[model samples]
Target: MFMRRSHDFTFTGWHMAGVVCLFFGTIISVNVYMAYQAVHSWSGLVVENTYVASQQFNGKVEEAKHLAASGLSGTLTVGAGMIRYRMVDAADRPVDADELTVRFKRPVGDHQDFELLLSPVGSGVHEARREVLPGHWIVEVTGLKSGERILHHSKRIAVTGPAS
Candidate 1:
């Protein structure tokens, strides 16, 4: 029994250094990977001309306020690769415009952004067929009359499941 010997696994500086390296290395690697993905997927600028946009910002706000004051609003519905846009005015009647410009953007990635020119179906209603890939999409529709942007409405819609 006295000859039965067991080796002790002693903790040392090398073990400590290895643990520290592993703990910090994983964090650093994850951070670097996330940063790279964001940088590659992100557009460099949200606004082309910051100064010009800032200068005209107030005017745009006023325009929006005026439109709201007029009780101009819209309802947007999306389903099955289709979009139904209905515009209404203060009297709760459908508003009519010649054409509409629809912008579809994916919130996460940059590859699936697209634009569509929708045609009017009836007074205050427009329909368009757009291949809405299954994902989170930011839908923006601007009612245009005589080639001028009049009513701007935006909504976020999620199309679930794998890309169809």
Candidate 2:
């Protein structure tokens, strides 16, 4: 005859309740953590007023057309801890501006943003050497002549750690 040793541990309501609580507790905790992350990462508004911005959209497009009509164009390059900007006129000749303001910003956040007032380093070449971290950035280049904006260019670029 073989005898099996029996213990007094049984599946009781308390045990079931503990298991259920642990299961739901894990689910609820995870949900809470994910919710916090989602809310914290995103800002509620993209713009102050979408309606006003939309209304002015046509004018902006028309302005861009007018700029293109003037044959005023600009090229921006970000590399080697430096930013280089060049403007050319309709005749494909280099255009020089009195002053250039460059606004560097992250696409999603306004915290990591900086503005640089650059002077002409060479003929039609405006440059500034700044050590910026590698990430996605929006470069807004504004060229002004006699305090009037002549060129407005927005460029998106990915910054690399190494000079390229």
Candidate 3:
């Protein structure tokens, strides 16, 4: 006659402790990773004051509409050691301004933001000699006439190299 042995397992305090630790540990690890990514990926500063920005939002929108209706458009070109912009009106005629400024800003942060006041080279064309770094950028071009903003344009672009 052969004797058979039965195997049994019990869920003890140690097992329960391990289960709780694993559950909480996973949650904590995910939270820490998310926090790290969030802090490193974005500047978290869209405006100096949210309330003030919100209050001025409508006015800004109206201004943008007016500017758009004016049909003033610009073409920006970045070269190895130069930045050029050409402005035109709705009729595709050259548009001149008293002052034109091009601002280069990063999409996620402002650390690399900079401005270049372009000098006109005739026929609504402006140029500046500056080396722009290769990366993703948001270009904001503002044109002023008699100290008042006349044209505001924003564009998102990816720069592979400064050659063009």
**Tens-place lDDT digits, model 1, residues 3-87:** 7449878899999999999999999999999999989877766778999999999999998887667677888877776777889
- After superposing candidate 3, which stretches have Cα over 4 Å from the reference? 1-7, 162-164
Give candidate 3's whole-model lDDT: 0.92
What's each prediction's TM-score? 0.78, 0.70, 0.90
Candidate 1 pairs with clashing backbones:
none
What does candidate 3's lDDT look like per residue over 1-164, in tens digits?
A: 97766866889999999999999999999999999999998999989999999999999999999999999999999877889999999999998889999999989877888998999999999999988888999999999999988899999988885534
Candidate with the greatest TM-score versus the true structure: 3
Candidate 1 residue-wise lDDT at 47: 77
Q: Indicate the residue-level lDDT of 116 in model 3.
A: 88
By TM-score, rank the candidates, best first: 3, 1, 2
- Cα lDDT of candidate 1 equals 0.82
Clashing pairs in 3: none
Best model number under lDDT? 3
**lDDT score, candidate 2, position 61:** 94
